[model samples]
Target: MKYMKWPVLLGILFIHAVAAAQVPVVTLGPDFAEPGDGWDKLMQLKNGNTFYLHFSRKEGLVVNVYNAGHELTVTDTVHAQLWNTADIESTEIDGIFEINGQPVLFLQQLVKYNPVLYRLVLDGVSGKLVREDKLGELPSVQFRSVFVDDNLASHDFYVEKDPESDYYAVALFSGMPVQKTDSIHERIQVMHFSPRHELLHQGWLYMPDTTYSYFSYINMAVNGKEKVYLGTVGFNTKRNGSEIKPKVIFSALSPDSATFAHQVLDYTAGFANVGGTIQVATSTANVYMLLHVPAKQGEGNSSIILNTFQLSTGKLQKHVQLVFPELARNMEMNLGYKDTYKGTPQRFMLNQDGTSTLLLENFSFFKQGNTQINKLHTNLGDIGIALLDTAGKENTTMAVSKYQVITGICEPFQLQRRSKSEWMFRNKIAALNTNTYLSYDYIPGQSAAFVLFNDYLQYLDTGGQDRVRKPLKYAVDANFVCYRFYNGKMERLFLFGMPEVTKGYACMMGAADYNAAVGTYATLLISRKGLEKKANIAWIKF
Candidate 1:
C-alpha cells in the first residue's frame, strides 16, 4: 500500500496521525429525493447491482436500483398487499437478505391481531418485486419488542445467517397465555432456510416448564444448516410459585431431531444472565457467553465469568473468571466511567487464528425526576473489546472512548393495544434523528479488522475516562473515524479531513454494505445542503 497526497485533504490536518496513508478514491452519484421514516438498508447483489431499501410506516417499501457506478436507475414502491397494509403498525420488517442474487425481504403483518409472516423477492437489477409468498403464521400469541424502552427498541423476532454457508434461521418469540390464569406464558418458534430460501427445519422450542418457569429472551444464533441456538434465562418460582430463580439455558434445534436439545449453563441464585448473550465462534465448535456475578454480600468488585459450550453436543466446555483491572491495563484504558458504568456485549468477531474477540458496548439506562417530571436516559457510547482464546481464556482487552445521547420531550404514541409506546416526534418529515447518523459499522478482514464510527476529536487519547459525567456535543464535533486493528494493536485515523467531511454530507454508516470477498464497503453519504437531501453511495476498498 502506497501513500499519496489527497487533493481534498482540506484545512483540518492531522499530518502525523494518518502518517501519509493512501486516501481512498471516492465517487459521488447524482442526487435523489430523501426517504421517509422507519429504517434504511443498503444491499449489494451478486450481479453487481445495488438496492437502496427504504421501509416506512405510511408509504411501505420503496426500492431504488443503482448501477455499479452508484447511479440511480429505477425507483419504485413495491406493490404487495402485505407490504402496504392499511394500518402501518400491523406490518414489521422481519428480516432482509440477498438470497441467490435477489433481494429477499421478510415481512410480518398482524392480520386480525394475529401474526403472519410473508416473503417478497425483488429483482436484483430492477428493484421490482418478482414473487410474494406466505411463509407461515402464529395464532393466540403476542409478538412485540423484547426490550422496549424510551430509548431502546429490541425485537423479539430476529434472523441469524451462517457466515460459512448460505443457511439462515428465522426465529420469533411471543407471549402465550389465557391458560385460565393471570400469568401469560411465553413461547418461541424457529424456522431454518437454505440458500434459496428453502425451508430446512421448523419447530417450536421447548423453553422450559411451561407453567412453573418463564424465560427471558436474550440472544439467538444459527450454524450451517445443522443447528439454531437460542439463549435465554429461565425463571422458576419456589414454594407454591411466588418467586423466580433465573437459570441460563441454551437450546439447539437440529434437522435430524424432533425436539430441541437443552443445556443449562448456570443455575445459581447468586448470579444472573439478564443482559448477557451468546456468540458462536466460526473457527471452532464452541459458543461463548458472559455471566455477571454481583459482589458477594457487597464485599468485592463484581465479576464477569465467561462460559464456553460445545456447539455440537450442547455441553459445557470450559469456564474462566476475568480480572477487570488487568484487562483494562492491557488495553491502556480507564476503569472509572463517570462514577458507574456497565459493559454489554454487542458483537463478536471470529479471528483466523481460532480466537474470537468479543466487543462490549459501555452504557447505562436510568430515570431522573418525579412522576410528573420524569425522564429516562439511555446514556450510551464507549466500547470494550475482549480477546478470548479457544479455551475461553481472556488474552487481551481494548476500550474505546465515545459519547452520544437521546433526549427532549418524549410523548407516548397510543395504540389500541394495551402496551404503551413512545415516539420521539420531530417537526419535519425529512429531518432525521441526529443519533441515527452517530452510528458505527464493523468489517472483518484477513489481515486487519476495520471499524467505522463517528465521535469527538478531543477524545483521541486512550488514558482518560471513556465517558464523562456531562454529555458532549456530538452533533457539532462528530467526525468520521476509522480504526484499523492488527498485530494485537490498533490505529485511529480520520476517514477524511474535517473541512471536507463538514460539507453538508454525512455517511449513513448504519446502512453501510460490505463485501468480504471483494474487500469493498459501500455507504450512502446523505447531503444535508437543502431540505431535499441528496444521497450518494460511497464505496471504499479495504
Candidate 2:
C-alpha cells in the first residue's frame, strides 16, 4: 500500500491557522480497501471517463469507473490469474481505449526491459471483459522511454493517440538481447497500432556508430498525423575515453514507409566547446530543437541554440542563439558548478491565436554523497520566457524569478516514499489565460510564505533527511499560494485559501485530472485510521 506521511503539515497548522477558515469544494468516498490493500492507479480516458484501480494480493484488481459528474458508473475486476503470471508480480494498465466505440483495456507486465502486453476488450455498458489476448512482446528500454545512455531522461515512455490518423504511437529504448551482440548499442523501437489494438507498423532504429558509447539521449515531439520527431543529443566518447561535446540527430517518422527521415546537426564545427542539454518541441507544421552549450570552456554561463525545421518540406526554417540575463538572484545557493547559472528549455506551446511561446526553467543538481541512494538534490529555479512569431523568430525574451526545491527521502521498495512526494505537486500548473499561467507553491502553510528550494547543506548536515526524521503523521490540511506568470514575469497571486478539513481526509493528488466536462480539477486520496483505508476525492473549480 502507498502511504503518505504529513511531516510539514504540523508546521503549517501552527503558522497559517487563520488561513484555514476558508472552505474548499470537496467530496469524500466510502471505504474501498478490503483487507489486503495495495497501490491505487488513477486514470482519465480521452472521452472524459475516469476510474480508480486498486490491486490486492488475493482479490486481483478492482476498478471503479466514474463519470464527469463525479458519479460512480461501474465496478469491475480482473482476476490475478490473468495478470500475475509466471515470474511477474505487478501489472500496469497502460491505457483504456474505445476502439470501434467499445472499451478495451491495455495491460502490460514488465519482465526486465521488455513488456508482455495484453488487451482485454470490455463490454461498454456492463464493464465486463468480453475477450482477452496476449499482444506479444515488443523491444523497450527501461529509463523513461527515451534512449538515455547517460540516464538523464526525466520522463518515462511515450504513448499517444494521433488526433488526425486515429492511430496510437508508442516508443521506448532498450538494450539489445544477449544473443544479438555484446556491443553497447541501444535499440529504439517505435510501434504503431490501430485504435482496435491492431498492430500497424513496427520499426527499429539503432545507434549509428560506437564513437558515442554513451549516445542516444532522446527527446521527441509529434506533429499532426504523419510526423513524429525523435531527437537525440549524445556525447562522443571515442577519443581516449574522454567525453566530448554533444552532437544531435533527428529521426522523423515517414508515414508512407516503415523508415525514418534521419537528419544530423553538428555543433562542433566552429568551436570545441561542449553542449550541456538538448530539448525538442513541435507544432502542427514545425519542429523546434533547443540546445544548451557552454559559453566559454571554463565559464559557467550557458547559451541556447534554437533550430526550427518545417514539417512539410523537412527543411531548416530558422536558427538562432539566445543569451538571457541571470535570474539566479532568487536561487538559494550561488556557489559551486552544480548550482551555477544554467538554463534548460522546459516547455514549448503553440497557441490558438497563431503565436508560439518557449518556456525555460533554471535547473541544477547537487551531489551530496558518493552513493546511489541519497546522492543528488534537484532544484527548479526561476523561469525564462521567449516569444516567437509564426516563422519561429524570437520576438522577446523575459524571465520569471521564483525558486522551488524538491527534496525528500525516497527509500526503495518502501510504501512511505511512493505516493508521498509524487502526489504533493502533481498538478502544479493551470492555465489562467492565453499569456498567463499559474503555479502553486506548497510552503505557504508553514508561516514562511517563501519558496523553499532544498538546500544541499541542510540535507548533508541533517544526514540525508529533509529536516529531521519523525513519526509519520496523517495530515488533513493543505495550504498553498499561487504564483502568476505573465509575459515573462512572475508575481504572487493570493487567490484563495485551501480546505481545512478534518483528519483522515487528504487529496491523492497523484491521481488528479482536469475534467473539461465539469470545468473542475479532481483528485482521489485516502483517509487512514490505523490499518483502515478509505478513498476520498477533492475537487477545485477555476
Candidate 3:
C-alpha cells in the first residue's frame, strides 16, 4: 500500500514564498568617475555612506576618500622615504574598524627588511588623521596576516600584570628563529599587545613534534563571545633531503584569548605537502577551511578540499572534495609541486549554510612540435557550490554560472551569492594579458558593479560571463563600485581611478554595509607604482 501526502509539499512551497519575500532587491546604475593614481585598497564605513581609497604614485603614496554619492571628501598623501631601488616589498592594509566608537585604520608597512606596523585614526567625516601611533617591531620575521579586534581588551606588553587576561591584541609572525648554533630553524610566534600599546605575551606555538611549520591565515569571530581561529601548515623533511609529508593543523583560542586548543584536522598520510587557508565570519556559525593536497610528490596534480567545522563540536564534520584527473594524463604539464601554482584547483568560498565552492584557474598540456601552436587544452575551470545538510548528508549541489576561458595571468576571482539559487562571479579586473584585480558590490534587486584595472572599464551580467556594457577605457590603475538608494531608486557609485605602477596590479581593497537609512562603503589605495614607498590614503563619500 503506497501513500501520498499533498499537505507537506504545499507547506514547503508556502515557506519558500516567505523566504523569498525577505530577500532584498538589487539595482545597478550608470558609471561615473572619481580619480586617483596607483590605487590598491578600499573600505566602506558608516553603513556604506563613506568610502576610503589608497594608492601609490612615483612621487609618493596617496589616499583619497569619497562619498558613495560621488562626492570627494578627503585626500591625504604620505611620502615613502625608501624609494631608491626599483624592487620594493609588498605592503598590506592591516585592519580598519571602530575602536572605542571611533574609526581607526591600521597600515602594516613591510620593506625588504623587518616589518613596521603603523596605526592611523581617521575622522569619520573628512577622513583626516585624528591621531597616529607606531606599534612595535616585528623581529625581522615574515608575517602571514594581521587583524584588529576591539574585543581584545588586554595589551600583550603588560601580560605580567595579569596572567589570566582575557583579551590581547596580537601579531602573528612566520619565519625561522635565530639559533645560537648558527643554524636556521622555523618558528611561529604570537605577540600579544594591550589596547594602549603594550606587550603582554610572546611564545612559540608548542607543537607535538619538531616538524617545521608556518601560520597562514587568522579568522576572528565576534558573537556573544570572541574567538580566534588559526590555520597552519606542517611539513617534515624526507631522508632523501627533500621536504615531504605535509599536514594541516587547526587551532582555536578561548573566549578571552588566554588559553589555546588545537587538533589535527587533516592527516596527509597519502597526499604530500597538504596546506590550507581558513576564514571565519563575523557571525560565529562555522569556520571555512580551504585545504590543498597535491596528488604526487613534487608534482602539480592536486585537489582542493573544503572542510567545515562546527564551532560547538570543534570537529571537522563536513567536507567537499574537488579533483581534476586530467592532470595525471599529461606528463609535460608537471611543475614544481607548490600551492601557489596557477591553474590548480583553489577553494574559493564556504557559505553560511555549509555549502562550499572551489575555483579552477589554470590549464596545461605536454609541449609538442611548437610551444605556442600545441593542441590548446581548454581548462574549462569550474565553480562548485555544495550544501551539507545538518544530518551530515551531501544533499544539494548548487549550479554555478560558468566563466569564460581567459588567457594570460588572471586576478584572484571573487564570488558572491544573492540567494539560494543566484550567485555572482568576477575575476581581478586588469589589462589585456595582464593580471587584473576588481572590487564590486552586489545588491539583490540591483545589478553587480565591478571596477577593474586595465585601460578598459567593463560590466558583466550577474553570471559574470555576458558583457552587459562595453569596455570604457580609463587611464586609472584601479577602481571600485558602491550602491546608493535615492527616492526609491538604486544607483551605482563609482570612485576616481588611481594609476598603478604595476601593469595589471592595483591596491584597491574595499567593503560595504547596509542598514535602514544609508549604505556606507570605503576603499584604500596606494597611489604609486613602486614598492619602496608608502601609499597615500583616500576616503570617498557617497
Candidate 4:
C-alpha cells in the first residue's frame, strides 16, 4: 500500500512539474543519424517551420524541415560533394534565415584555403533546394571561418538579415593592405541584396583611420527605409594607460548616395581601452553602444558606458555612463590582466517595449540576451545582466552565480598570469577546440529570462548538499540545465533525467534558438545509443 501511494504521489509531482514549472516538450525528430564529427543548427522560422541543417565531412549537407506540428516533413541533401572532399578546411552554417517568406540557407566553407559562401533557396512547402549560388567575390586573400587555426587567413565574412523586411547584406573583408598612417583600411566589399536574393548595390565600406590599429566588427543592420548601417570598435594600441581610449565608428550606406555617412565617436571624458568586448547595434534611426571601460584613474573596478545616437542626423540621443561601485573588483591591481568581476557587455538584447538589456559575464572562475540585431554569439562565461529602461532612467545590473570552466589550453588559470599576447592566444585557442558543449543560451522574457547550459548530473538535485568535492562532468557527460530568473532571483534545474553511460544525450546548447510568440525554446539534441549517434530536434516550452 505504501509503494502504491508513492507511485501516485510521484505521478502527481510529474504532472505539476510539467504544468507549473517550466514544462519541456522534448520531441525528438525522426531518427536521422549522422556519422561522427559534424555540426547541426536548428532554426525556428517565422512562418511556423523549423529547419534542422546538419553537415559533416562524410555526409556533406543534410537538412530536415519540420512543420508546425514538429513533424519531419522533408529531408534533402545539398552540396553533396562540398563536404565529402579530403582537403576541406573551414566550414560554418551562416544560418537559415527567412527571405521573402521563404527559408534561405546561408553557408560558408573553404576548400584548399579558398573561401566562398553559398546561398541556397528551399521550397517553402517541400523543403527541397530550389536554387543555389556562390556569393561575393571569394576574398583572394584566403579568408577562412572564425574558428580556423589563425586569423592570418586575411579575410572575414558575415551575413546580416534585416528584421523589418527580407533585405539582407553581406560584408566581405577581402584583405587589408599594408597599414598606412594616412589611410583607414581597404578592400571591404558591401553588397546589399533584395528579399528575393537580388543584388541591389555593391560598394566599398569606408573605414576609419589605422591609428587605432585594432578593429572588431560590432553589428550590421539593413533598415527597410533605404539605410544600411554598420558598427565597429577601434581601440588604441595601449597595453596599459589611464588615457587608453576606444572609439565607435558607425557608417551608413544608402542606395541613394555614393558615399557613407560616418559618425566617429570618441568619448574622451570617459576613459576605456581594449579591456573587454565592445557591443553596438543600429536601430531604426539610432545607433546604441555598450562597453565596459577601465575604471577611472583611482578606481579599482571597471565601468559601463552606453551611447545612443540618432543614426540619420548624427545627434546624440542618450549617453548613460554606468558605474558599479558596490561590486568593484579593484582590477587596477593586476595590470588590467585579471578581472575579478567582469563588467564587459557580451550581449545587447532589445526588448519589446522600447527598452534594451546588456548581458555581462565573469569567472572566479564561475559566476554568471538581445537583438539588434546581429546573429552573433559569445563563447562561454558566468553571468551578469544589465537592464536599461527607456520610460524611467532606472538601470540595474543583476549578477547570477554558477560554477563553470571551459577546459583546454585556454583554461581560466592561464588567463590570470598571461599578458595581452597570451590573452589573445586564448581567444584563438577557444576557436581551435570549439567546445559546443561549454556555452549557455537564454530565452529573454518580459517578466523573467531563462538561461540554459550543460552541467553535471548532480546539479539536477538542489537539496543543499555540498557539491564542492563532487567530480565535475562536462563535454559529452554533461546534462542540460537551466537558470530560470524571476523576482530578482534565479532557480537552477536540470532539463532531463541523469543519463546512463551507454545510452545518453548531449544538448548542443550553442545551437539553441527561442520563439517568444510561440513560447518555445528549440535546440539540436545529440543522442547516443551504444556506438551509434543520432541528431534530433528538441523543443521546450513554458
Candidate 1 per-residue lDDT over residues 284-393, each given as its tens digit: 76777655443321322335556777877878877776444444453343434443234544555555445766665555566755543235545556666566676545
lDDT of 1 at 269: 47
Ranking by TM-score: 1, 4, 2, 3
Output the TM-score of candidate 1.
Answer: 0.77
- Arranged by lDDT, best first: 1, 4, 2, 3
- Compute the lDDT for candidate 4: 0.53
| Per-residue C-alpha lDDT of model 4 across residues 245-285, encoded as one tens digit per residue | 55656677878765556677666332333232212244344
Superposed by TM-score, candidate 2 places the C-alpha of residue 164 at a distance from the truth, in angstroms, of: 6.4
lDDT of all predictions: 0.58, 0.44, 0.37, 0.53
The sequence of per-residue lDDT tens digits that candidate 2 reaches over residues 182-256 is 344334567777766667676654445543443343445445445666665544433336455455666677667
Residue 335, model 2, lDDT: 18
- Candidate 3: C-alpha lDDT: 0.37
Q: How many backbone clashes does candidate 1 have?
A: 0
Between prediction 2 and prediction 3, which has the larger TM-score? 2
